[model samples]
Target chain A: EAGVTQFPSHSVIEKGQTVTLRCDPISGHDNLYWYRRVMGKEIKFLLHFVKESKQDESGMPNNRFLAERTGGTYSTLKVQPAELEDSGVYFCASSQMRTGELFFGEGSRLTVL
Target chain B: ELKVEQNPLFLSMQEGKNYTIYCNYSTTSDRLYWYRQDPGKSLESLFVLLSNGAVKQEGRLMASLDTKARLSTLHITAAVHDLSATYFCAVGSNSGGGADGLTFGKGTHLIIQP
Candidate 1:
C-alpha cells in the first residue's frame, strides 16, 4: 500500500506571501493529521481530520494558518502572509485507526524569507 | 500542558555496542511510540507501546514503557551502522487515538561506527 504522500516537497516563498501544502492519505484511512518541525526543534502536532471532520485543531499556531480536508479524502494546509517564523518542514500523516501506527509523508519544506 | 523529554540527544557507539535511549513525559499517558528517520526522509514507525509495562521488540531494537514511572526506553542491541539515524519517541496525550496529535520529543541522533 502507498504511504502518505505530500506535494511540493519543497517550497520557498517571500515573507507575507501565501503557500499551500497538500497531503494525500492512504485509501480508506479515516484519520489524517498535520505536524510541523522547525529547524532545531522537535516535531509538533498541528491538527487532525477524521473523515472530513476536524477532530482537533488545537495545535494550529494562529489564525493565519488554516487546514482543510475535503470530502475526507485529502488535506491542505494554507499559510497566509507567511512569516519568517513559518519556515519549517510540514508533515502529513495517516492511520487506519485511532491510536495506531502513523504513516508519514515526505514532508514539505517551507522556506519563508 | 504536555511535554516529552529525551536524554542523550546525541549518541556515538561502536558497532556491536549496546545502549538505551530514554523518554520521559510530564503527563500521564499510556500510549507511546518510536520512530526512525534518515536525513531528509519521512518518519518510519518502529514500535507502538501501549498500557503500563508494555514491551515490544523487533530485530535489534526493543522498547518498553513504564506508565508508573512515566518513562519509555528504546534499547539497541549489538548496534550496527545501519542503525544510525534519528530516533524519536512520542507520547499520546488524552485517552483517544493520536488523532489528538502526538507530543514528540527532540529526537536522539544515534551514530554507530565501525
Candidate 2:
C-alpha cells in the first residue's frame, strides 16, 4: 500500500506570499493529520481530520493558516502572507481510526524569505 | 497543555554498544509511540505502547511505557551502524479511543559508528 504522499516537496516564497501544501493519504484511511517541524525543532501537530470533518485544529498557529479536507480523501494546508517563521518542513500523516500507528509523508519543505 | 520531552537529544556510540532514550510527558496518556526518521525522510513507525507496563520489541530496539510515571524508554541493544537515525516518541492526546493528534518530543538523534 502506498503511504501518505505530499506535493511540491519543496517550496520557496517571499514573505507576504501564499503557499498551499497538499497531502494525499492512503486509501480507506479515515484519519488524517498535519504537523510541522521548524528550524530543526520538534515536530508539532497542526490539525486532524476524521473523514471530511475536522476532528481537531487547535494546533494551528494563527488565522493565516488554513487547513481543509474536502471529501476526506486529501488535505490542503494554506499559509497566507507567510512569515519567516513559517519556513520549515510540513509533514502529513494518516492512519486508521482507533489505530495508533501513523504513516507519514515525505513532507513539504517551505522556505519563506 | 500537553508537553513531551526527550533526553539525550544527541547520542553517539560505537557499534555493539547499548543506550537508552527517555521520553516524558506532562499529561496522562496511555498510548505512546516511537518513530524513526532518516535525514530528509519521513517518519517510520517503530513501536506503539498502548497501555501501562506495555513493552514492544523489534530487532535491536525495545520500547517500554510506564503510565504512572508518564515515562517511556527506547532501549537499543547491540546497536549497529544501520541503527543510526533520529528517534522520536509521541503521546496521543486522547486517552480514550479517540483519533486525536499526538504530542511529540524533540527527537533523539542516534549515531552508531564502527
Q: What are the per-model DockQ values?
A: 0.70, 0.65
Q: What does candidate 2's lDDT look like per residue over A1-113, in tens digits?
A: 78899998999999999999999999999999999999978898888899999888878999999999998899999999899999999999998864568899999999999
Strongest candidate by TM-score: 1
Report residue A64 deviation for candidate 1 (angstroms): 0.8
Candidate with maximal lDDT: 1
Q: What DockQ results for candidate 1?
A: 0.70
Error of 1 at A27 (Å): 1.0
Q: Across residues B60-107, which tens digit of lDDT does each residue of candidate 1 receive? A: 999999998999999999999999999999988875543488999999
Candidate 1 accuracy as lDDT? 0.93
Model 2: per-residue Cα lDDT over B58-100, one tens digit each = 9999999999999999999999999999999999866544437
Decoy 2 TM-score against native: 0.96
